[model samples]
Target: MKAFKTSKRVLSSLIAIMLLVMSCQSFLAADGDEKKPLNIPEITLENLQVRGGSTTYLVDNPPYSETAPTMRDFDFGPGSDNMQDAYIVYNYGNEVMIESLTLVGWWPKDQAVKNISLEYFKDGQWVTAQENIEVPWQTSGGTEEEVEITLTEPVTTMKFRVKINSAYHSWSDKICMHLMRPNGYIVTEFKPLTDAIAQAEKLVSQVLIGNKDGEFSQDAVDSLNAVTNEIKEKLDAGLVTADDIPVMIEQIETAIEEFTSSQNPMENAPAAEAENLTVSLGNTAYLTDRQISTGMTVSFTDSENPAYLTLDFSGKNLNATGLTLLASSSDKFTLNMSAEAEIDGVWTEIAAGTDFNYRCDVQGTEGHKITFDSCTASKFRIKINSSTAESFTVYEILWDGLYDTDTSAMDNLINKANSIIKNPASSDYPDLLDILKIVLSPAENQETSILANQGKIDTITQLLSEAISAFDGLAQYEKGDVNHSGSLEIEDVTLIQKHIVKLLQETDFFDEYLADVDNDGVISIKDATSIQIAISSK
Candidate 1:
């Protein structure tokens, strides 16, 4: 009885195996002769939408009279039952050669696929290239397992046949294929103004998300946020507004390209250190008579060049008979003397490229002292160097603490002096004198005149400010009204005519302000005629 039971069990197992084999054969032959007719119609696509960059395509069976061809229905059972078979055809549209191809899907469970075969159609005939390209069914499917079959020569059609020599575990769906092509684009960079607007709009969209009903719409909020951030970052950092966007983008892109090309960072580092500027100090021709007895050196060398250097003297009335080059040849010396004196005494040697500077010390004083001696040297640069009583390394340093002043004052003074020299009675000497008095006076005593002079300054400032404002306002108005009729370009020149008539209505010559190009304030036929002339010409 035990022997009979064993035999029966073996028979049952054999019968099950036979049934599985039949099922596998049926799956492989599903698209072959012994199957119901597939009613799905052939479909083709033309003029596909391509963004000219990274794009992907998937073979999606469209909803139609039939469910369409799918690999899910093909069942490849456990154990070596029957051969598994599947075929795929791809056509290269517009003669574009396929750079790369990949087939992807979940792995089969039971066993691995024995091989894959490829065929190509060319010269009006089909040709089989490979019959056994191995693919492991138990392994995961991705780009890693992609079979790179290089044709070397161009072909119009590619056919792949996946064959299962042994039964493997089933997969939920058939594998999908992807063909990759490098990106191409015509517009490499964006327009500056347009890019700014787009960025603003994007920010607005993010900030106003889900706040559709708020006072500021998503777009407005984004625009304001973007513009505000841009102003704060760029303007504060001092970036110029008129720079071209493409130029900047190209620069950044070029940097990226260079980094990618070189790949080695240290290769771009500085090869060697740079040389420093040489600077030193030397004695004046004649050390002050006081300096002679002080047991102190009147000269020094600027140890740290490109560094600030200063010299100071205080206490007892310091006096020097004369200043001499003092034997050492050097290029650095600047001095401020209270009394006119000789620079560098006899027998002292002056070096090449060396310079001597002298000025009066009036820092906290009412005025400066006159020079007592002559500065000896064939050549020397003499600068005011400021009346402040501080040793400054650079000339610009002396102007640092000064309050903002009208640089035009100097020009005005010079002009006034010239006018006085030319025809003194015809010019306004009092006004010129008043302006100069404020300029030449010591800083401590400048308060009263400054306060009294504010109104006159304001009048002049206002005239200039108003003229500029008017011109800018008119330009902006015209820009906004691009239609250019008097409105923009669309409507009649109503505003223009009104302004013209207003100009004509002005009567006072000196007091009333109008487009009095002649400065003779009365707005008469001349102003009206000027407007008329401009309009006619336009």
Candidate 2:
């Protein structure tokens, strides 16, 4: 069986445009606040046109009738009766959650599709959105009949497929299918502006691989590199923002058009091959001096059970969408949590505390995810405060960020990213020979490069994406929150003394959770002594 080809010039163009738009937009999106439906462009996947089963005649038929059954432009053949499987995917430029899909076919009741499965891409793989989708065999029907398959949850992806099991031999027109992204207010803000550039730079490296391997012409490389540099110019001036993400994605659609266009078609670009990114935090990361984690060096502010943790990304800046923390308390309690980052050498508040109501049944000993101010920061600090409690325990902190944990992989990626910043998108960089090396090398061989010794790769597409996120793979109670309030004041000392003298209920919030200040997981006078120690030493 033969595979369909992708346009050669479009991909590099897509990479360049996405970055240019990202370089020109805002930093924050209020979740789902924008009221108007965004003008997200539809992505075209050149890789998905292929053969899966035998005896299935693949036919590219024109529109069966006028109004696209479900509004899809084209349809494929139902093929001969035995033709069991055929798959196709459409790339919507931006990542979108599709809740429903519509399919239209003009076939005899016998030839109509009987069963189907719908899948969407998430993380790094495809997940079944609707399995065994039953399609009532349509009697000879007009081309206007539409079949809608509803999904359980909104599946986010740029590519999705419908695999038809069996169909009566189609005599004439094929089926046209339409996929929809919920037309709701979609906030374009995702990652920090600079991170978007990094992602764009990552895509640039991929195109360079195609270029070195003769998959892309020099003209394509020159054109893309020029756009990449313009993006860098914007970043250098700190002129970019997060609101550009949608436009950045739209730019990718533009590139795809040029990529798939006959102008300079690459020989073997895979259909639906690009793996979306979900960059994670790495292992070498650590908290302040590893101090509080050890339970040895305990410090307190003027408040009781003060819950706070500080982290330094060092070379890896934290540009997270949201953060999650693990808080420890023997009993349930509420605390106001806040996050701050050091930007421009001064501390700035990013996420204001919107205290979570801690219901013992639902939240358990763990606190929930928190939304904070989003920005790239060298150092980030999280503080949790309580009005009624004095001491609590914080178990862990997690930051969601970009791919490449092994600093070396990031270093290689950074090298490529820097070239984008250093050069123009239209100029050619002869030094990008490293792109082919990064693409073709086995991931386990680090002697050559850091990314070479990591996650999944070998194929050009996987290599590009796995290269970024290949390194796969936090707490808390605000401790000393003794009175069940998040502060370390003399009032906590009074509560602890009272608890020990049989004046207080053992199950009360303060006595149960914060009184165990030493964090032995048990209540004891020693905890009171330790809280005093943390106080006097202050």
Candidate 3:
């Protein structure tokens, strides 16, 4: 009875947190929304031209148009050896006060200069940000450079001309520029993600099996927290990323509620869903939610990139008959999506790519569906060949498929892994990690063949069984004790801080499942701040 009481108390508190959070979301959203909109007149671009640089070293990028940056190498024009010799006159129809000006060089670091200086028209006057900034500066993200410059004050002008007499670079001798911008976008469409998380958390405690301290599944918790972190990353960058937020949040919520599904596959099993597919472009994980952008989806990739992306189901032993590629935007574009299969590691295009058409603001026909011969070979690849839109954004990839191997045992293992990850004891770390590897088996770069490959589906089941036999039982853990030190201290806060700053880099510190002090699904910097405050109050 006492144990039941304790469990009830914890749950009651959590429910309260959920309710309070939901009530304040509207208020929070309102706070972020603009109250008094900034008044600014419309502006137009007129006959703009480049001047002075070495006319011999012409920068070729198409000026102020085209979604894809089409400027050829050495696009910065009228290129004289003198950097000041090159600049553009931006003639506008109306004069407006712009808060900032940023010149974008779509490349990575090391290849471009980090800093630059130029004089531009402001209030009908030509001036530079720093009179002392005489020489060229350095740069980063060499593959795609985004150089941002902020002015001391808003520049009011009708016509602005910049003169760049010189520039500097550490790697490539030539400088190629992309686009310039005013400021980053602010996304207000976040209610879907927040509402989904809140609803899922409200229901989770009701489904938890045991009364132990870390009774809930950590994997489900981590999955929720991971999305939370990814959303934070996008918001910090000031990017509008809510297009797929509703879908992603829904998928996660479904994953959380999987326990509500029937345990017997015969009764009901997980069908082929859109979430299983992986995407990338030539060697780089372009659409992968793994980086700065939400691993769930990305903005856009230049279809013109010779090395395009492939969505593959090569190692899952799953034979797919058809595919559906989703476009985030409604604008009509040539959809160059194709399905290919590999025989002896060679890819043969199975479906000829076609144009994908959609009318923005129109209903239906937002995705392109392709049918193909069913094959389970590891070489199956799907590529977005090209699009009418210079760059197109493909968010979700869905397929119709079935596993060749028996999945009864696999499903059972997945359930067990989810359970163990949610409430791991101190000694469950090694096995917990092994379980993760199994669930995420047949990962990219795994050997291609079943005979020589260690990534076989059977291997995961066998490893999972062994790990289960070694369960270390459960232990109570303080919510902020990330290091499993048995007590919450200043060091625990520091460890989480280090993880946030990229100093420690360990993502599995939350095995105890109690490290999420606020139960927001994420162990973010805010959690660290909360811990410090808790310590002070004590």
Candidate 4:
């Protein structure tokens, strides 16, 4: 039966060759014109025409249709029934020389095309260029097997045909011829560079000049600007090609790195402190530094008497987001811990943990972190609950959040006061030195004080200005000494009152400027009252 089938295939090929010769001769006679072969760099679907096939299977399924296949359409065929006689002819519409043909087979080892014969039409006759070419089965799942056949001598033809002699399977007659191409395929698609370039330009525009956060140095900014401009010019002039896109993108990336690396980091602000921090067991407060410092530990071995730590920012608030506890146990034990924040006089639990058997290994201390949504509160507490531990040491505790206060005003005031103290106008006034010394200390403290608000800073500034004014007044006339008696006394108070009731004229008073004791631009009962108060206090 196999010998009979082989004889039948040989006879079928002979008959097909005769028919192809007749068709070619008829096509040549119809044209009766000789023309030069087209200079096509590569064959593509647009230029190639495909026709002729046996009955197709699954032609209506997706990625397959009744429509004829093109040069690179991979899901072209699975010739049904008479697989040995199935043939496909590809026409290039014009004569072109092809050096190699690549055939991609169907997936799944059994359904792939196995053997094929290649024939080309030249000199008005069908010529067998290659015979019995074997295509390997696609054994690698989901990946197509491509077989390339390099011709012993390159062939020039307007059309070629591939005869599907056999497939690996014969039961279902399922055979597929996936793709065929002269030479290899070329992809010409690329993503547009406009969006990427625009994004880089936007970053450059947002850069600022300063040593603060999000600011860059002028040199870095300038360098980035130059690079961006050059790239933009090249893009605008259409000098950039699809092949150049990756290199251009890399250049922009390098420029961004350089710009970021050139930034001057912001100066680190001093660490903030709570207004009052205490660690206590019940009513008794621990006398430690109440902070996370080196060699500091608040340990309690008795599980019956646990301790809790509290941080009070007075009336000020912190936007608390997270906290860390650096703790270790002397033995294997479970240390349960929890935290709460005071909101509107109510203590609400924020985070909790248990089964922490953290021990001091060779790596030193280990920290457990608890993170939660940010909460605005003035007081926070960490409770070390009852645990089965011989002893546990808390080396440190750190809070992560922003202190909910803007101290820029107080900071500026301190700077101004420091300038005045460093560059004194005159050293003769010991009283002025004393007053300034009193003003400078509190002003400096407010710069980092969590309790410092704008209202308090404004009041302090007003008071300091008044003190300097009174010091200046001493050089001219004794403030509040309206009687010129060389002292502030009851007579000075009486003269201010008599002058207010028109008994003594303003011209009769000694230094009427001194009579306005409060420097409120008026000599009235208020000045008399101020003098009396000063005398009584003295």
Candidate 5:
């Protein structure tokens, strides 16, 4: 009984194979042997419709000629209004693979359609297949030039639209095309195979094999390639029939699924380290010192000329990533502020606020912050203006970025060493004095060179720190000695007072670490009082 069942199954398989072969042979013998130009019948008003553009000229009897093709805007003589946007759509009633298009222009020079765009409907949407096609204009009483455009690849669709973009004459906007012929094959029977081939080609072009995002594994790539090559071989040999198409499409789809499953997720990859560059205020210049308080907080009153503040990064380029404006007002005020960046010697406005309303009593009125993509600039300016006379106090104008040549660490170490050397106590020990001078001499002379070389800065900072630590006498300087003058004196108290009041410039040399006598990690009136108390006790 088992043997009989096996023989029956084998016979059924053989019968199926024979049926498939016979069907392919019959199809090839019929019209599948070679491709021929489609025999599209004459397009009349019944088959053609105006999908887009003017519909006035699409009537059965136009104003110019009743026999002329309806896909035209007839010229009403010179100085007539031209048709602006016009599109003629043709429904072929069945799927066809379009290969080329032939356009026959009118004989008149200025009345003929000069340019056109072709679009086809596919998958429920109209897609532009070709554009900017120039149809040659025929001079009066001259031979007409028929322009034939061969498509890069055949498009399969049931409907198409022709857009008349321009006319030959500038004076008249009238566009006329005598006739249009599309050439290709009706591909209703081979639609499945063509669609599958297109999908496989798209997959092959998009798939990648690498250790990155959206990349597939090598095994997945190899599997896809094997299946694609097999399908290509069968297609080229003309052995692929209707029955083979389903299996080939299934194999390609399965390969694509496997490739997608093998893709590496972004979360599994190592994350990139972010830059931790230090932030500091740049050198600022005021347009006018009148009615302005240039202290820790900047304040300006409304004047005839708008007040402006410019921040220069000391000739160093910065990739500015963010900005902040800290301001407070007792009364309600509205002002206009424009932020400009000096790019290539020109001040270009990047951001502006037409009515920047601010009041201390209002919620969310504390500050304004703006973050942008990295912008490289060495200078930036802010201009403030208002119609009503009002006083505006800005506590801080912060710009966040990474400098091109970051010498922040080196600069900090240099300031520390300079503070130690400036102290009168270090002069007592000649050896310590000579060592400090020698370590800072190279930095003083080749400042620009050291700024460019990060390795050199690291080496010098390490050496200088080690030398200062090795000498115990140089490291034990008295606290509150802002000038490093070796002792607690009135001069130290005065310097602290000046710093607290913002009387000193940023470029002014002073030791902030030592001046913070209160050890609260801040320089305030308490630190100055502490130094005065210590001096009075002595």
Candidate 6:
């Protein structure tokens, strides 16, 4: 089957514009309060263009820099010598998770935008998030144009680019983006503020003086003096009453005392006392400082004697998902006791058909995979389905030394993660990269630039540098090859002219998938384009 040929110039122009869209606006969103500003990620500008007075957005030739700006300054036209094209690049921290993006176009009069589109990374490749929206902007009588598009899914970073469609009136083609921050809220009340200020002040004192200066000490004396001076000045200026001064200072003193006590190193930190565990539905347990070695059989059991459940850990990670029914040998299995629930006053069985009602899956059947699966709530009762009273032995896993343990598994994980991250829109990429860092950081520290157990950090460092160089090269190649063909053919120019849409959306179509060509995981669009550019140059 013949693949579609896309215009390089049009595609780059569109993608670049979208990436730049992030840098154009400086809207600071509040996650919950004005005190805590939301964090927006940076995106890359791959390409942008204006032809026949129409605009188009495209995928960037090179992968964007992780540290790229999230937005930029935009200025369209004063007419005669107007800027017909522009592009930008950016990266979001960790992951992008926003519901929608709002754009405020800065224009003098009502103007029309030809087309608008968004591109984002997903599934290890840059994929189109939404179908193209071709709403001809009839913005003729406005100072600033406002447009908002709801996204199909949450995104951490994206490229948004729009082109100016010739309008009845002349206006500047500028737009600003306002991103929603996903950090949520720190506090919903003002009480936290007073406590915060007090805590800060206390920290300052502790750092300057000794921790022993608590209660009625010199540190306290100095703190009181400072408070008295401030209160005296405010009172003299009629800013506060004497009663208000005492109340304020008292609050300040209370905060300082709390801070001093909190920061002080305790002589005897309480040791955690291990308890013979009880397994109950709704009983919460946190796994910290965990490890897995070759001969470990992980399991969980109920509080009652004679009954216990063992989990199979033969595969990689735990693969149990919501409401899992596990057993050691089919005899001592743990399952939700109640098969039904009471509605208002009457009881009813949960029904057998739907996956929601009741489900069961095996974990250790010789060739099984371990995964992080969700299970039914711990609140449910554990019914021992097996009539034989027996106690199953599940070997407890041990905690290996922190950092890289004795295995090649960490190396394999890092390699796999690197491969996945390079792909656009791969949900697991970010997490895998994160785990690699945590696991490989010791290796990273052992050598200046090499990854853990990769042997010689320089090798990995070189790979990173090479990847970046390839990305840069792709960006340059896309700019040089405006017309889509491999050799700048006449048909390529026509392709760019006639179908602006296709050119913008599919500029480096196959490269994104091909870049991670070897499927080792770490081929970002920039990596793919760079390799293509290198090949074209050769």
Give me the candidate number with maximum TM-score.
Answer: 5
Candidate 5 lDDT over 431-493, as tens digits, reads: 877887798777655456623444456677777777666556555567787875668888888
The candidate, 1 or 3, that scores higher on TM-score is 3
The candidates, ranked best first by lDDT, are 5, 4, 3, 2, 6, 1
Candidate 1 overall Cα lDDT vs. reference? 0.29
In candidate 4, list every pair of residues with a backbone clash: none
TM-score for predicted model 4 compared with the true structure: 0.26
- lDDT by residue for model 1 (1-538), tens: 0000111111223323432342234222334534211111112212222222112222221111233211211122232444444443443211122222223222333233334455554443456654554443334432112123333333333222223343343442222222211111111122343344443444334332332221133443444554445543442243423454445444434432332222212211111111121222212211221111111122223323322112112111122222232111122234332212113422221222223343323221111222223323321221222222122222111100111234233323332222222333323446544443343332223333433232344444443333233223122222212122233221223332444466433332111122332333343445445545555666
Candidate 6 runs further than 4 Å off: 1-38, 48-73, 76-89, 108-113, 135-138, 156-538
Question: What is the per-residue lDDT of model 3 for residues 1-538, given as tens digits with 9 covering 90 to 100?
Answer: 0000111111223333432343233322245753221122122222223322322122112332234323233334323334443444443322334444444343523333233343445433576644323222233433333334555555544344445544444443454554333321222444446556555554443333343322344555556556655654553343424466666676665665453231112111112112222333111221222111111222234334422345544354557687676554435556566777666678777777765665533542255678888866644545655555543345445566755555345445554444455554523477556656554454211223333222355676676666655554556456677766667688888888776776775464543244567765556888888889988888
Clashes of each: 37, 78, 48, 0, 2, 74
Candidate 1 C-alpha error for residue 502, in Å: 99
| Model 1 misplaced stretches (Cα beyond 4 Å) | 1-85, 93-100, 108-114, 136-167, 170-538
lDDT of 4: 0.54
Worst-scoring 10-residue span by lDDT in model 5 = 1-10
lDDT of 6 by residue, 129-190 (tens): 55444433324332333344566664543223232222222434333221211222111122
Per-model lDDT: 0.29, 0.45, 0.46, 0.54, 0.56, 0.33
Q: For candidate 2, what's the RMSD?
A: 31.2
Where in model 4 is the C-alpha error above 4 Å? 1-307, 313-316, 332-334, 354-357, 385-388, 402-538
Number of residue pairs clashing in candidate 3, backbone atoms closer than 3 angstroms, sequence gap of 3 or more or interchain: 48
C-alpha lDDT (0 to 100) for residue 191 of candidate 5:
44
Best by lDDT: 5
Higher lDDT: candidate 1 or 5?
Answer: 5
Candidate 5 residue 261 Cα shift, in angstroms, is 18
> What's each prediction's TM-score?
0.17, 0.27, 0.27, 0.26, 0.29, 0.20
Worst 10-residue lDDT window for candidate 1 reads 1-10
